[model samples]
Target chain A: MTKPADTGMTEASAPVILGQNSGPLSRAISRLRGHSFAVANLLMAPTMLWLLLFLALPLGVILVYSFGSRGTYGDVIYGFAFDNYLRAFSPIWLPVILRSFLFAGIATALTLAMGYPLAYFIAIYGGRRKSIYLILVMVPFWTSYLIRTYSWIVILRSQGVVNTILQWANIIDNPLDLLNTPFSVILGLTYGFLPFMTLPLYASLEKLDKSLIEAAWDLGASRIWALLTVTIPLSIPGIIAGTLLVFIPAVGDFVTPDLLGGPDTLMIGNVIQQQFLSARDWAYGSALSFSLMAILLIGIFLYVRKVGTENLA
Target chain B: MNDGTPSTIEQCEDCAIRLEGVTKRFGDFTAVEKMDLGIRRGEFFSLLGPSGCGKTTTLRMIAGFEEPSEGAILLDGVDVARLPPYRRNVNTVFQNYALFPHLNVEKNVAFGLKRKKLPKDEIATRVADALRMVELGDRATYKPDQLSGGMQQRVALARALVNLPSVLLLDEPLGALDLKLRRQMQLELKHIHKNVGITFIYVTHDQEEALTMSDRIAVMNMGTVEQVGSPEELYESPGSRFVASFIGTSNFIDGVVQWTATEGSIVLGDGERVIIELPEDGSRPVTVELSVRPEKIRLRESGEEVQPGQCMLRGTVRDVVYLGMTTQYSLHIPSLDRVFSVLEQNVEIASDQTLWVSGEEAILTWHPSHNRMLPSSGA
Candidate 1:
């Protein structure tokens, strides 16, 4: 141990090597250290630049625009204003936010209910055919998101195949209004994001040791009870991942509400779009976008804290 | 080892599990083929083999994880082939101790009892008993991840044993443990087997572990049972070269019969005549292998008198390895190319030189009965 006075003297003085305070050797060492730091910064430059340009800059822009004034021609004015933010707390936006949440929650629930068994089948029973089935799950996306969403329109419309079949079967006297409803919005969202939910769930379920289930069986758990007690609980992380993937996207989706949901089904994303495009109010739209971003960031922070960073990755 | 009590006799006499022609196939691949075994109640039987040798497959089939494609599995005389694993009367202690990560030690142990729908107090009592048996009663609230590997393994054992199943299937349960912990757990497992008196169907590739704990061992290879016998039977009198080499250590010498009759003898490839016993109606000029344990080979001086019924060979000591307890000497025998022999550390050789290689002639002999003759096809 060094004496306290020696420690103080050492702390006050510059670090020296070979008992030399400053010389060519120290300059060479400093150059080497500078070169290493430069190389490290160069290696990490692309990722840091990407975060700044694509993530941080856009988020800063949105925050700044949230507090700025809306010009007459839908352009942001560089002046302080809190009116748009105050309007966000009005009953109009509150109901819209609650409605969007309701739609996202239902879609998440349905997606989980439907995706779980499919994921379980692929993980446990598909065996050597797992990758093939995974490719099959992704095959729907090969055609285009818009076309897939339109295909739902073709099926769920009043005179579409589903309604025609139901009418011909005499299950209903008249064609059902399957489209232009909250039900249609939920159905479309779940259909579009089902694979996102199923894939993560499959990854978690596949990692489950079959012997653990066997051990449960050896412990004399019934088939249903084993699923409830062991299999489902062990798959909690996957379920959370799937729920987040579906719910986060569904809450902010404007296409599903535009195509499948009618006038009363306008969500917050549609409201933001209307504020900037039709209403020509950039300030309100930017504030609304920033609020959504803030809520999502808090949600993701809680999620990472609950699960782990590696699991989220 | 009998207790001389009628109750003990009755308990040991019962057959806890019996498999009849049980065969499991994963699509085109045959995992376990035509396995027939009867595990006695309260006996520790091990299915020992290399990987993909159907040992784990057999244990899984017995545990009802894999249904045999063509056979019957009887547990306590009840057919469990068509039954799912949950309905079976057996528990499995899996490799890596697949304890429920979400549940604490007590809850994991209590899981089985709750399924049986026993009263809450009875479940608690059995859980406590099992935890005490594994010497982990105080760690009731700890989750599996919170405990050390050995403690987690004990919790797995306790979880399985709490149900009091007729048989416990341990699928390489100690495979993941370190060497010292494995040895300690091996003794604990044996002691638990004695205390519980439940049939144990252990699966492992470690011959030393099988020899130490198993009452009987079924050695499997390529989805077939090579041999099933007690440790001493399998080690001492192996019926085939695979068993002889697999169980312990043996040096094989390829030989053919030059002259054979009631008093059997054969000339080795290098013109050394070794004495051997023949079957009741053995054939002539048969290609066979002569097996001798390293311990049976003896070293003697060149001019030593050759005793009756002893085979001797002249070989130069090429290298010696001092193995603390025993020194292994690699000898270059002209009759057999090269051979290795182990001698006890206490024994002193005739020569003092290391590499000048004096005393090139070493006489090796053993009883003719110890010289097993095996068919040369699988060589």
Candidate 2:
């Protein structure tokens, strides 16, 4: 970039004048620079159009519908009403919201508790086997998520491998009640989101300066103290990233609950899915979809505000 | 218990660290060969070597970051060979200044004190003292990323110093800084050494840095100590060709010993005889390489040259580099392809291209003392 401009100025082929002419070549190059800026702006036009049309338009539609009335046959009616939001906060809906939060929170916490050690082990001690370990973490992700979740049914069912093993081991007299419960749902969600929790945390932990830990050790901190004060604190961004990844997706997840959870432990996602397909209430479904999206958006907003946007390039 | 511990600490102050035939090996590669080194109380010692020469491994062994494959390390008269790094009373200022990016400067400096569970006020006072020591008191509120390289290095130093460890291990602490800042910090480090009076084990590949600041330097090569001496001693009388070459520029002349006199001097195969003191119970025809420092060799009027003494090599100036204070001459001698010579700027080398080059060849003389016998090349 610097060389071409110097060449242009150096290869002077103009009539000698009191002042340099700033000739047609220079003008053309300057015009080319202007055209390049315009081209760059033109390059962004489609993406701008995409955000405005698809993203902003859909969000606008949802926002409008959130405030509007519901028609008799479950269609959005274009009249202002706060009933859906009010209904979202009603005593009847509180249990569902609380249940979603509890499930997601438990899943997030469990994912972190399990994933962090795995990530830390991979980063610190996996050595030449690091890629193989990482591949193992990603293997479950390769199988279709639904298929993996369904495979849990095979393992958790009455005659499944887990029950058979337990029976063989004499730990249980009968096949245990493992599937179709909140525990199963939580287990399924944790299994599904393990990779999501591990990869980013692994990335952050891998990039962590080993010298910081050494510095901690130098400061007379025990290994556990060093990890708690230095390693864990430094890895918070990864924790936040992993938590949001697990929690947001698990909150809106219907498949895990549908396959593994009992009717008594049904989450908001299962209810929303039932509202759309079984109940055939499109208005309430849209409202429920909007609600899930709102929660996810808020989670993402907090995540970005706290860790992502503050440091991410 | 406190009285006994204090007495123990007092009695153990003579040798800050001692390594007994320590050897570190990673797989088949020997990072540190069987080595013995002792660091005295409150001394600034540098482990000087090129990259992969195991200077860092030695320092890490001392810091308890690495365990020796053989032998033990005694810290303050106590066997700390198997102790974890956290259990050792040693701190390391890592090369990149490895400050916790999430912590502000004050918090970074205070990190060690926090780990020790010091009183809050004590931690604050010590952190302030550390920051002030590094002249970074005003930047306490800034995070590591907010500071420049020099400031970051100071923060690392402060973090290490605040702990008041029995020893401070600086692993190329200024290696990451720019040249000007590096020089500035080198002096700053020397001042810190003077102020703190703690045993410092600094590791660096830079010869000049090691020469400038260390109380004693251990010159290492190929996972072995080449020589150990003060800067002047190492530069003036290197024990091997490696040390001679590594410490400063030198001209090596390889020749066959033709004859020996009662004194150590000998005659070469080409009838270019020179004299040097001989070792007791000398053997004959012992082939040896002669090491000559560049600055010690001078050019003079050819015919008026002093009688050839211990060693002399006829060489011509091939090129000249005119540095502001001193001039460097690249001389080409048939013995060795090239030899470098540093001379004062006023020592004019006239451009009469065919000028005879010889001087009081006595300064070029080598003694049995000066001649460092090295393994003969497999010619």
Candidate achieving the largest lDDT? 1
Estimated TM-score for each candidate:
0.83, 0.85
Of the true interface contacts, what fraction does each candidate have? Answer: 0.84, 0.82
Query: Per-residue CA lDDT of candidate 1, range A238-277, in tens?
Result: 9888999998988988988988889878899899888878
Pull out the clashing pairs in model 2. Answer: B264-B276, B264-B277, B264-B278, B265-B275, B265-B276, B275-B310
Summarize candidate 2's per-residue lDDT along A196-260 as a digit string, tens digits.
99999999999999988888887888899989888988887888889988998888888999888
Superposed by TM-score, candidate 1 places the C-alpha of residue B39 at a distance from the truth, in angstroms, of 1.8
- lDDT tens digits, residues B39-61, model 1? 78888999988899999888888
State the DockQ of every prediction.
0.39, 0.45
Give candidate 1's whole-model lDDT: 0.81
> Candidate 1, A290: how far from true, in Å?
3.7
